[model samples]
Target: MTTVRIPAGWPATEEQARAVQDELRERVVTDEPGPPPRTGQVTGVDVAYDDERDVVVAAAVVLDAADLTVVAEATAVGTVSFPYVPGLLAFREIPTVLAALDALPCRPGLVVCDGYGLAHPRRFGLASHLGVLTGLPTIGVAKNPFTFTYDDPGIPRGSVSPLRADADEVGRALRTREGVKPVFVSVGHRVTLDNACAHALALTPEYRLPETTRRADALCRRALREATA
Candidate 1:
């Protein structure tokens, strides 16, 4: 595990954080179709928090895109960089996540975040922030569409509906399993929305959540427990 420290000049208030978001949001690339699904290494990044202890633990698990096999994993623990805030939650998580990713032994080809990207109120979420910082092809596979509206998809695997913000389509609600609730997918950076959803499906061959997410989520939670214990 890597240890993390809050970067100097990190956003100290909601206004500062939002200002940072506004500036970085403009840099998020949405034109390119990222790496083809299931072709290269794909990594899942997730964080666990112990608010009472002011500790955050982040995990990055790299998987072989073709077979969903784990290739490398790293964890980082740090003081929570920011206070609890809704849309700005990424600020609290990003520092340790970057540290975890930096500690990884292998290159993380396409990163999958267990949070939002373009499907955000500010149109810049964890995945987008991380992508812009690392210049990686990244996507978000979220369990819930935060404040967004989407029609229920068909009761079959691979079904999808547009995740909308008013009239503009921001992301997708993708059904990875028959009769299952859809996972929200969004373009983070250097990836198209369609390709992002395709990668989400490719990562979910066995579960409603992507294997990358499932594995990283478990690892981060465990790391948090160990750190706190």
Candidate 2:
């Protein structure tokens, strides 16, 4: 795997966040109707933090895109080099995610992350950051919205609401399973908004979260647990 360089000195500050957002928006594809994806295999990425150490423990879980079953897993450990800024979380985890993805024996068709995407204040969340760095089709599915606003989908699972920023549609807040909280779905890169939702929905199997995310979350916890043990 090729090493993707992280742009040094990214503003972890609010001013920097805005600047980077503009840069990212200009760099990212916002054109209508992206090209059809020809590849397969969807991967889920999740992070478990060691609060005391301020370290990021993460996992990447690859699944059969058609069947949504786990096929491979990779783990990574790294420091949160960036601060916990509201819209700049991609800086905190992109390196660790790249490390973990690099360790995977096989490449993935799509990557779904536990964060926001085009719905971000700067439109460059973790998903977009990693997607741009890796040139991968990625989606951001967050349990909660960051700065974007929309009507709640309510308690019923499978309900959805549009995530709008500045009175424009950025993404969707989807309820995957009943009674569980909804997740915000947004396009990261090289993927359409509808395709992002399709990938997320296809990975669900009687769970509030996608199969990939569930697997990665469990893997992340296991990594943290084993490392601490």
Candidate 3:
């Protein structure tokens, strides 16, 4: 696998991080609502890192978005090249994710990521990185906001919030299931935020995260754990 160096201590200087983020914001593709998405399969992609072995594990899990059942699952492993910078997360995880996608037995209609989408500082988070790299439609569902801020819309589930980077509304924060924490939803590529949020909601019935992320995250952890065990 190809590699890119992360800075010595991992995280970047605040200034350097901000610069990269500003560059990303300039490249945002903010068009209006488009055509409807076809009813099709959706996949979840996630990564778990093991610093001791300098390894990254990726998982891709496809599911029936309408029914929330697994269709296919794949896992891949690779080295971590980049350091863990706050905003520049895509560079570190995407390589392994591609490997995970390559191992998939079936192609998914779309991908839901456990990271950022347009909610990123550059407006291109993990979903955007993976989508463009693989040319697949993707959305990001993150547990926390990186550089974006918004109201939490209270709890009780299904509460919605608009994510703002500075002052611009980039995406929406969605609660997947009742009593579950909200996941930030944004358009990563070839999709709209609304569509992405709808897809995420359709794939969830239990837990805080959508089934794809929940399962894929588990798969990635298992892959790394079993390998090092």
Number of clashes in model 2? 0
Specify the highest-lDDT model's number: 1
Runs with alpha carbons beyond 4 Å of true place in candidate 2: 1-21, 30-39, 153-158
How do the residues 1-229 of candidate 3 rate in per-residue lDDT, one tens digit apiece? 2222343553245566556545644544435342244366888898888898898888889887667778999887787857887767877887678877887778876888988877876566788767666767778888887768888766756678898887888888787666556788888877877777777666666677888888898988998898668
Per-residue lDDT tens digits for candidate 2, residues 120-202, read 87677888877777878788888887777888786676678899897888899887887677788999988889878766666
Error of 3 at 224 (Å): 0.7
Superposed by TM-score, candidate 3 places the C-alpha of residue 186 at a distance from the truth, in angstroms, of 1.2
Please, what is the TM-score per model?
0.99, 0.86, 0.83
Q: What clash pairs does model 2 have?
A: none
**Candidate 2 vs. true structure, TM-score:** 0.86
Per-residue error (Å), model 3, residue 156: 4.6
List the candidate numbers ranked by TM-score, top first.
1, 2, 3
lDDT of each: 0.95, 0.77, 0.75
